[model samples]
Target: MKRIAVLGMPNTGKSTFFNRFTGATASVGNWAGMTVDLMMATLKIGEVTADVIDLPGIYDLRGFSEDEMVVQRFLESTPLHLIIIILNTVQIDRQLSLALQIKRLQIPAILLLNMADEAPKFGVKVNAEKIAQHLEMPVISMSAKYGNQYGKGYDAAIDAIAQTLHQQEHPICVRNISDCAIDDRQLATELDAILQDAVHISTQHSNTLTTRLDRFLLHPILGLPLFFAAMYLMFQVVYTLGTPLQAFLSFGLDWIKVAALEPVFTPFPSFLKGFLIGGLYDGIGTVVAFIPVILLFFFCMAIVEDSGYLARSAFLMDAFMERLGLDGRSFVMSLMGFGCNVPAIMGTRVMRSPGLRMLSMLVIPFSLCSARLNVFIFMTTALFTPQVAPGVLFSLYLFSFAAALVTALLFKGQFPNHDPLVLELPPYRFPTIKQIFVRAWVEVKHFLRWSNQFIIAGVVIIWLLNHLPMDVPPASKQTLSGMIGQAVQPLLQPLGINSQLAIALIFGFVAKEVVLGGLAVIYGASNDAGLGGAIAHQIDWVQAYSFMLFTLLYIPCLSTIAVLKRESKSAKFATLAVVWSIALAWITSFLFYQGARLLGF
Candidate 1:
């Protein structure tokens, strides 16, 4: 197959462009380092089928960092013929330099001034024909993300690619080694001179829309607080809107259990009824009810991201997070973890250092992910007043970062990411309804795909443990989970954790969303009349908060652990992750409970 390599500097939408043509869902983010590996897919251009490879984004073709090395090695090993280099038209000042360097390679190239649609809004204009003449290559103005949803400018790009690939019969590189060894200083000066005539910008405008907004959004004092405020708002909205939807979902599930399911299972044996209807059905249904919260959280994030504010947040984050031995870009990974930790772990591939990538992988699990979000929603709403519920849930998010920062610092000496993180602030764009909904739909679909299987499997396992070895009345002391929780109760007593919560935690290890279902199964409460009230009566607010803290800090869900193992390529590191987190959860919960009691709470 003809090999076409998509190359560009970080955050130019290379992966986005690649996904458009290849129809592959390679992770695309608003920040840098999204494509850490060579993601290849089959592209059939008109009639010829070629192999499309999406290379890691880099500033210079010269190998500098781990990602750069990966790019260099792939270029050397793979016989590539066409290079599709994407450039952000608004930031041509920085991006054009990379294109100039690629020009030196004398490869068969097609340059895309992507996101050109946003250039006019930012008071910048690019003459693609002029630039093409200056660089002696094909330059096309287009937008990859816009193309991602609609065929606005996408069809033209595909035609250009197909025509270019068909015409370029020679190999990608034909120049001698000396071509890239030219004087760097003189080359940059010459390149700037060439681009001067090809691009136009208004210098009279000091306060563009982006700069005007950044005054507050990226202020030295307010940036961090605003970021937190944004986070708090996201959760507040999630809880506020999600709770009612959660109640609605619970109603549907209760109807199914009593009216739809119970009738069918009426003739079954006690063990089967208890295991399937009450245990499995009730357990899975409880977690499913919280899907609205998950959906809302992702929808809000999608809007924030599409508006280009998320990249600015990453730029702002680089300043404060540097103290933790991580750059602000790590903030993106941490937030992605809120959706799911597996992709976030894979996202560490964007960090340049092997050690730094590992540090990022470690920091992510501590982020309060959606799986744990369900458990928090249940505990906070069940335990606290409406006025206090958002506060409690929001505080847990704060603690998530608190724990993550401490974890990053403790591992600072062990894993240091020395290279400074470089991120370009993308021009702020007005988010369109279509873009927002598209993003929401994709996330909702992913949430269901990534979660449904895990949820069902975890719920079924909890059902078995509650019923097997004896036909114990569901959640009785003789159950297997009960015996195990009893054995561990003394260890957890310091944190005011009871036997039921202990068993729930054990099942939660499979997946945190299961904790609520585990509660319903163990407490013998129906979905509509389930453990929410029981938990409120069983434990005081102090213990409830303490229990929430313990849940927040305990080990990563099984899927995260498995990914950590795979990414770190060591069982020992994964084992360390499990041990460290559980230890922290225990100690943190213990101190909180004991101190709260002493303070007369």
Candidate 2:
């Protein structure tokens, strides 16, 4: 099959165009390095089928950013039939520079003026045919988000492109950069001539809404407060709305267990029945019940992202972040870390400087991800009253920021970086209902896909460790997990973590999403209520808080560590991520628990 690459600068709707044409659910986010790596999908246009590769967004071919290097390496090494170079129409003046650079490669290419619908609103008009005549290539003006369904405008565009492809005889040949080099002044002169001949602009109504909104949203004094208020409201909605949904889901799963599965297993042996229902059903089901909460959180996050406020949040935090030897982009990665640390770690590829990316990897794992949030909600509901539960949950988030801040400061000396933050503030647009729902659903599916195996395997292992040696009481000190937890209890005692909880922490190393399931298995609880009751009976509120703190700061999951190792390309760096975090976790929790006890809490 012929290969085509979709390439562009950030926020140019390149990925959206790729998704609409190829039907791949590549993550659509409004930030730099969102693509991070190449995403491949198969597409059929007219009578031809081809492989579509979505390359990471980059500003210039010669730029030194990780994403730029990725694009450069791919273009130089891979033979291709065509390159679809997308440019944001509103920013075409500068964006054309990238196209000019690519043209020097002397490869077959198409130029897409993406976000065309928004261009007129910004007082911009482009003559695509005229540009095509000038550049000797096909130029298409399109809003990638529209005509999403099959056999629509986007599909027709692809059909036309395919027809063009059939006219060519051979795969594209790679060209050396040194041979294509042109003087900067000559390139600028050529770009100016093209803009003068093929583009028109009116200044009156350009970006009016964006400028007006930025005044208030990016204000020095009010911007930070507004950002915080928005986040606080987001979490409040996630919890207040998610709690009932979680309870209903828990109830439904329990009903399925007792009403459906219990009868089917009745004829089986007693031990087999107990193993399936208790070890498998209850443990995994408890984690599954938290799905609604996770979905709601992502739903809210999707809105923040699609509405174009995510970039603004990064802008507002940039000044403060710089004081800590980081910048706004790093702050944005930390925010993405709140959703999941593995992808956020991968996102550090957006940074141009290697040291900044390394520093970000070191700090982003400290984010209070939704997986850890599941543990917090479970414990907070069980230990704190409804009136104060949200406060307890919010405190964990604050702790996350504090932890990231300290990590950045302590490690800044090790990884020195001096890159300035450069970010685009896209015009605010109201996201469609379909966009929000699809984004949330995709993320939910992602969480399920990534976590299911870990959750299931961890649950089974914990169950076996607790239930083996049938002569001893289940979860008793005589069992495997019990003896292991006991062996580690002395070390954890200072932080008020007990043997059973210690076992949960050990398994949590596999994945934070498994921690709740591990606890369900360890405590022999059949449901959320039972698990809550069992935990409450075993530990006081103070101990529970200490455990939460430790869980918040400790080592990242196995997936995160692997990504860290791969991204940093160093085993030592990944090992440091593990050791440094656990040390920080121990010191912080010990201080908090001991200090609270001294203050008579």
Candidate 3:
């Protein structure tokens, strides 16, 4: 297998091309730094197997950022037979500077003029064959989005690489290296000549509705309001559209418990039946049934991303982000982190400044991810009636943003020289439905897989914690949970949470969702109640609201911290996230509880 490396400036569709070539969708977006980790896929090009490594997006090779170092190390250490340099055809001069640097390494490389379709619309064109003749390597002009246009050309490029591999000679040709120095005059003259000989200009209608909308969307005053409105609508859909589906799943699960499990377990003892019905049916089944809501959220996010509105969001927030000690680009990663923190942390590679990347990684975990959304919904819907739940949900999301902002400011104060945000805006295109579905399916599959493990294990643990006394008489309020809750009750009393809810908050340190699972088990033992009745009858709404606040501000999950350690390479930073999050959660919950009490809640 030959190793093929994909390199490009940020947002030049390197990942889009990589996905097309390797049949792997590793999150392509108009925004930069979409692929942070090394994504490798084996593809059969004709009869030969090709291993493709999609590296992080970068502008210049000379940088101290971790992502640039990752790319540099890969190039220096790996035995790459071919480098497919993806360049934006519209920005030829800037793109070719990096191409020239790669050629200096004397490696066989193919210059892929990606986004060829946009060149003419941008009043530029390139003659690929002429450029190839000058550079002494194959040049391919193709749209990665429309693969059929360059399917044969891609194969031919690979065939050319395979044919030349046996001949132990570098294919790069450099004449008068001094002339290609890319200084002011020389670079301009060469670009002019190159454009004169091998390019064409055509006036084409490039009417973009996205650009027109951006006039309002990118307006400083209007942009934030619009963003909040759009986000509010998104959340509303997650609840409004998702409610029927959630209800359907609940009804189905209830039917299975009564119609299926009860009949099958008729001969079993009552405890065994309760274990099967309560633990499996009500516990794991409820978690799994929320797959539709998760998928719906993913699908909506994918559409917004593919339509290129997400980039505008970043552009819109640049000024506000600057004040918070984060670049506008950090918002993109944080937004992705809301879907899942793993990829969001990984997405930090697009930030060129090391300080900003680390800061973004530190704060991104505070973004409430979709995994925590189910817990939020369960808790909020149970505590507040449906009429008041939306406000509670909005407050939780706002708290996440506030926590992240404060964390970023703290880091910025510590490291004062972080680089400011600079990004290229790509022309917006309507995302293909197939692409949206594929990405959504990938996320849904991942969530289901995690739910199967963590949720199941959590439910079982809660069950064991509640039931291990082996049919002893039901414990009173003075039992284990009660004792622990009472011990911590003073610490959380200012937050309006009672001893039982306080105990669940302590258990939430294990997993955010476990807070709900713990409550279900505790209340289940008390009155044979499920999650619904547990929250409705036992926990006060004030306590429930305070619990949500704590959950929002509390330490990130173990996996999130692990990613932070790996990404930041600083145990101190990870520890800071945990400590500060806990402190903030306590402080916030305290204020909420005391304030609510004052307001006579």
Best by lDDT: 2
Model 3: CA > 4 A from native: 25-36, 149-196, 200-211, 261-277, 385-387, 449-453, 471-486, 498-504, 513-530
Residue pairs in candidate 3 whose N, alpha carbon or C atoms collide under 3 angstroms: none
lDDT of 1 by residue, 120-210 (tens): 7767878888888987888888888777454345677778888988887765643343446556897688677866887888776443677
**How do the residues 370-398 of candidate 2 rate in per-residue lDDT, one tens digit apiece?**
88989999999889997788888888888
- How badly does each model clash, as a count of residue pairs? 2, 0, 0
In candidate 3, what residue range of length 10 has the lowest lDDT sum?
27-36
TM-score of each: 0.86, 0.94, 0.85
Alpha-carbon lDDT, every model: 0.78, 0.85, 0.72
lDDT for model 3 comes to 0.72
Q: For model 3, how does the per-residue alpha-carbon lDDT over 1-601 read when each residue is reduced to its tens digit?
A: 6667789887787877787676764432322232244667777665556667787777766545667766766665566667888898877866776776666666678888887776766777788898877677788877776665645655665566566454423333333333444454654565567666887766564536646876777776888899888887788888777767877887888798788889999999877776776655566666665677788889889888877778878988788888877878888888888787877898787666667777888788888887788778877766777778777787788888888888887778775545866677777776667677777887887666544556666666655555656645432444555556677877777777777666556666656656655566666666766567766786688877787888777888776888788778789988987888889888988888888888998
What is the alpha-carbon lDDT for the whole of candidate 2?
0.85
Clashing pairs in 2: none
RMSD of each: 4.3, 3.2, 4.9
